[model samples]
Target: MRSRPKEPRVPPDRRETVRHEIVSLLTGESMTAREISGQVGIGEKEVLEHLGHIRTALRSRLVVTPPACLECGFSFRKRERLGKPGRCPVCRSERIVDPSYTID
Candidate 1:
């Protein structure tokens, strides 16, 4: 039987590298957690955690655009924190837009 090839090991400093990359990407453009995950080669959950930790370290502000409800066009702009909303307060629609982040 042939053995499967092992995946390359991640560096010990991978978390720091990912955090740096996240800031760089956000500096260029605003993106959702999903988008950051794809570009940074990390899970969305990891991206969220990193964002939480790096909030005060960045030179520019970390802006989070709150998730919006698509059904009623309700903008969740007043939300004071990061993370997706459970449902639309106005329409109760689960079809909500994921919040995005940008450093500016």
Candidate 2:
């Protein structure tokens, strides 16, 4: 198994701009948090936070499809949080699909 070196974190002052940039990027296609983090050079957790802000900033333009349990097809539409759930409540399955976001 191999590990990659870490990338430098985006400065606090620039986070706002990055968040806006993220929204602009999403206008073209839906993307998961991991993909956003990799492309934006930030951590996954940071990407999640930015997503929340994006939701607030672009209420009419943003569209988020909540994650679902692949095994039992349980939808997380009721969950208010921004990240993926750990397990499925109906079937207790760990095979959950990640939520995706896009800007309309």
Candidate 3:
């Protein structure tokens, strides 16, 4: 009887790098910081930090859909940061939509 070759196995702890994983996820669809955090099992703040670095490091465009105020319909187009703004300047409403990110 001929013996079959053993297949190499990857360790359970071995996983794709966080940034790479994030890139893959973003490639499929746009996601908010909170959504990315939930998918990657990381804090939302950390996700934003990673996104900041990815924005600079990635050759492909990293597009940011800025958050908008739900109440006043104000868009945060000029905002620099990735995180959601505290309040809307037009209406002073705290109800705001989260910014989404995508790689194009």
Candidate 4:
């Protein structure tokens, strides 16, 4: 069996990535992962994944407003995940507001 040749790695500066575009979109206005997905033409889950990296890359610039339960007025201020909560712990309601992100 013959071994296949390896592909060349892209240089960091030459790679055209979406992280910059994502940062630009998040500069002033706040948006949910769904909203970002729509704008960037990616899935919501992918947006959340990008956000995880962005949080570290941008440091304090990326601000995440925590999700809140609409039914019970419970705030998920301490929650760390980027995605919306499945259900409210306090009232067991699924009507939870999505966490919004913005760049400061």
Q: Please report the candidate that would top TM-score against the real structure.
A: 3
- Compare the candidates by lDDT and give the number of the best one: 3
lDDT of all predictions:
0.86, 0.86, 0.89, 0.88
Q: Give per-residue CA lDDT, model 4, range 7-103, as digits (tens).
A: 9977445234777778888999999988888988778988888899999998778999999998889999998888999999999999999999999
Rank the candidate models, highest TM-score first: 3, 4, 2, 1
**TM-score, cand. 1 vs. native:** 0.79
Pitting candidate 3 against candidate 4, the one with the higher TM-score is 3
lDDT (10s digit) by residue, model 3, range 36-83: 999887789999999988998985388999999999799999988989
**How displaced is residue 75 in candidate 1, in Å?**
1.4
TM-score of model 3 vs. true structure: 0.83
Q: Residue 26: error of model 1 in Å?
A: 0.6
lDDT of 2 by residue, 1-104 (tens): 99899998876556457887798779879999888888887898999998888788777577778999999888999887879889999999999999988987
Looking at candidate 1, the ten consecutive residues that score lowest on lDDT are 10-19
RMSD of 1: 3.3
Preferred candidate (TM-score higher): 2 or 4:
4
Instruction: Give every collision pair in model 2.
Output: none
Native-vs-model 4 lDDT?
Answer: 0.88
Alpha-carbon runs more than 4 Å astray in model 2: 1-16
